[model samples]
Target: MDKHAQKIAADLLHLRGQVLSKGDPVALPLVSSSMFHLPGDPEGAAAYGRVDNPTWDALEHSLSVLEDAPCVAFPSGMAAISAALFATLKAGQTLLIPSDGYYVTRLLSDRFLSQFGVRVVQRPILGFADGGFDGIDVAFIESPSNPGLDLCDIHAIATAVRKAGGTTIVDNTTMTPFGQRPLDLGVDMVVASDTKAPGGHSDLLMGHVATRNTALRDAVLDWRKMSGAIPAPHAAWLLHRGLETLDVRFDRMCQSAAIIAPALADHPAITAIRYPGLATDPAHALAKRQMSRFGFLIGLTLDTKDRAEAFITGCRYLRPATSFGGLHSSAERRARWGDDVAGGFVRLSVGCEPVDQLLADLMTSLDRLMSK
Candidate 1:
């Protein structure tokens, strides 16, 4: 790695104590086709800001190294997914998505793409033994899906899709590239919401797409130009900076999450604990095969929606909010988003906080909920 790459990597690895000094200013790099050329020389100044920016270039380059695939940063994770889908699928083509897909992707397919002669099919995400993917033009799979926390057999499904002459896309948002690298495991492309782990501080929002195929990269670039969904240079820089410490932050959070998941599994006030690390998790073996870390997100279904609400109100440490994979712990009632996720289900985004402190807060919250 070059000096620049090494600097970024070092920052990421030692995030625990590193702080931006007063003299260090985080500025957005100027958008220039060629920084060496005069600004008045339009031809030499490089392409339009839409195509490239130094900050974004730094992020893209860093991410490319980390993922070991060509990386493209976008305004949001959904935008990366949209751009990839738009670039790959066309009118009169069919796209197969998991039946229980991410709520946003499901909404985008059902509401927006249908009018463009695009057909979105919902394939069952049942285990490999079930042969869930029978026919599909492109298969989109999310292992350990949102809210439901179900796992998909990515390797098996990807093998089936390739044998049938179909494309495969994996949403690696929950696992991030730190926990899993789908491209190495035979998937064509991997998408992530960098707003989570990659931007560990939770102050920025961005997304990324990495693929080994050159043709697909070109297609996504074309779609990105047309859609005007490129992220601002500043956001890209933040993502790049945050990625430096991603492994450390996730390591801490995963350790905490592993402890919390099984501890809550048989809690008297808890109905069920959804975490892939658990031996009882439906996708345990598959997750163990695909992911290095079990991840920091955890789901708990309380006895009832009312009790769920009570638990939400009772929690003192975990903030009642949405979004996960941040420096601070956050909790959310899934039904608040109309997810059909059990009313009492509370999703937890475990952070780098002391695990014992978090556990105490959780136990107290459950006890309070039971009292009510």
Candidate 2:
């Protein structure tokens, strides 16, 4: 089998040589012990739970295949992001972040980074290449940026950043590794809140960072160890369960978005829509070149925040959720979270469901929104 298929099999069956039993269980048996008997050879595999575990190893290997490099798993998405930040940036360095990404990311930069002596600056994702990377120590790019669905030119921007003695970190959560590979574009690191698509069931919280650069990979690994930001073996197994269906699930979700986005765009109650799958979207041309599949996330604007809330509340198929990439559709009023977006803006996560039923549910909700 090809590498991706092999990785998927590894995720699904967890078939490995280490399972010495006559017939290994299909799932990874979580190792719950905090410490293992190291004896005199502490250098072997299966170290303390904080540093290594078999469950994490299987999933990390699969992710490493997806990213074409080493992978480090974390307890939460922010933990992985924090590891990247703390690993690369020193007190005096400047961090250039996407102004349109997840709200908490902005919070981390503005509220958290400043206290450590690092300077934080915000820039929109669409024109990131022209943002001028000189004197910038780190640049964080979130293509198909959260809530905005804006795309960035990773190659051009990463090239500029490197020439200026800066590093580029791409948040690949929206697209997932199957959708885009930033390492191929010269990014120094790829990080994601695997809690979203990677943990598609929404029952687990996990994150990971992947890098082709050995030094950066080793640094992030060390940071994760020192910070104790490791995922529980059981949580890692749950992430593995969700990831087994990632390729199929992501495709269905993207397909759903392809239909839903244009339909929303045409609705009278909708003021605007941002989805790269639509040819008229500002990010379409660039996304077509950069992404393997247009992402599952959709952004639409209504007349008001109340109307947006009503629309989500009115939907039967789409759940009112702050998260994304599950089996059921969901949406949230992003501005309520203090994101610097339009008060009427909503971030919709397309889920895997029958196309007609999903489309009808959303359109009907909008009709109800208009009636009210």
Candidate 3:
């Protein structure tokens, strides 16, 4: 097997290596590079709170295995992405981005980085055969993109962009490292909101960037050191705890999402549904080829915006909120989030709840919306 495939196998087998003590799992790794007294430890290394932390390093290592790429962790998803972007580009450089990328990422490119004379163009990223991605230094992509759940042809885009001497960075937040390994598909960098599935509880917010290129990896590490975007030790520890059960949690969540996505697709009140796993989705073929799992988020658009709001509000159990990959199934109108997502669109985050309960709740909520 190739090195990437070996890494994938090793990562999938990581849970088997957990040191079991008296039948209870240990919370921390057995080996740590902490402590200043070690003979080989670097001198004058007490470089403030942001440079390095043992807890964060462990999480980064664990996540690197999962992602099959060397990684760096940050306080939030945007921090990780921002550091990566800064490392890759400079003043007057241009990056081509999916028009439907995560809102905060678009904000960073348009609202913040624009001040530095860096330009971001939102190209049509849903399909392949490259019409919109011409002449860009970098391509920022999101498969099952935020709110829209639109899957781009990662390998296609990666191949075309690489031929043109452009780099590719994919936001792998929605699919998690377990479900989708972007690096294996030839992307230059993979960024995940460790705050989501990596943290799993919605209580902590963090981000990680995984990459194979040593120079880019070192650049991101240096950017993090300079920008002070490092994550808290405790938060890193919490994310590590979540990583152990990632395979288990995501398996259940994806199963539930598969059940609900089709039901929502066939519903009379729903006009559009975007789930790459669904056979009818435009990106289904690309998604099936690139991703191991279809993931848990589904974007469904109702006939009207009012109906979308009604369904979210009327759900007896589904919470109306931002953020996803938590333990409780939640639904929110994507357009309300200040993104360019269509107004009638609803984004559903499937949780670890029973598939039947989520489906029943969804059906009831749709009925309620139809009544309105």
Candidate 4:
């Protein structure tokens, strides 16, 4: 087995309560109390739940190992994003974000960050590596950007931003830390919506920011504590449970996507398809160089919104939903969410379903739509 896989297994298995205990619990014990009892000295012990929790510590430690840095957890992906932004940017500083990445990030910058006197700049993901970062204080990258599935050269972009004396952050939501580690690729910080793939199930919401910089990590932790954006102990426990099976689950999802994307590309109903796993995809070369796995997201376009809806409706396995990185296959038409894409474009999040079944379901849906 690979060393990383072995490390992950050991970390997760050891999360079971007290390795030195004579009889350790089969699972990590949930400490739900909001306050820890102070006998004499409260100096070293947890004082408040909002500021700290054992469950959160376990999850953060596991994530820190994977992310190769110290990490801070938050209630949701947006909270993490907001924390990273607030911790990094100051008034009159310039922030650069991917134009085609997750919409809410842009919304946050425009509606709120701009009011604080921060200059916001938008750039497409395709050629971002070569883009000029003059006067940019921070560059927010989203390679294999959400909805579009576009790729950017992380090392190149980070190198440029660093040369210009700016911080670089990558949203690694689509490709979990297992798939890609931006820090290893020269990025200063890595933020992700653990609510997506890391959570594995659609039931919980969480996010985290990981960085080698101790100061930044401390700032993020302070923001979470002061803003009360900390995740629930239960949610953190659930995420830790999800992380235990993430290796197997993520492998199956990627393998299924490898099979399904090609099959979808060949279908007459698909006008265009974008998946870094595909050799024909424009981003394949960079993805191969940077990512260990090609991930499970596929961007495909049908003829129109009606056809896309019909295709989704005809599929038995694909659930029409907004979120991705769940156990169940889900898809959504991006244009409906005001994305700058064709009305027919669909962002498909492949799941752990058997490849043959998933392929058959997708092809059957396309065939029926064509016949109609």
lDDT of each: 0.79, 0.85, 0.81, 0.90
User: What CA root-mean-square deviation does each model show from the true structure?
Assistant: 4.6, 2.3, 3.6, 1.4
The true-structure Cα RMSD of candidate 3 reads 3.6
**Cα lDDT of model 2 by residue, 277-332, tens digit:** 89998878888788878888898899898999889998889889889888888999
lDDT accuracy of residue 369 in candidate 1: 66
Query: Which of the numbered candidates is closest to the native, going by highest lDDT?
Result: 4
Give the alpha carbon lDDT tens digit for every residue of 229-262 in model 4: 9899999999888888887888889989998999
Candidate 1's displacement at residue 118, Å, is 1.2
Top of the candidates by TM-score: 4
Give, for candidate 4, the lowest lDDT window spanning 10 residues. 11-20
The TM-score ranking, best first, is 4, 2, 3, 1
Give the per-residue Cα lDDT of candidate 4 at 364: 92
Model 3 stretches astray by more than 4 angstroms? 1-25, 29-41, 44-48, 127-129, 132-134
Candidate 1 regions off by >4 Å?
Answer: 1-45, 127-135
Between 1 and 4, whose lDDT is larger? 4
lDDT of 3 at 361: 89
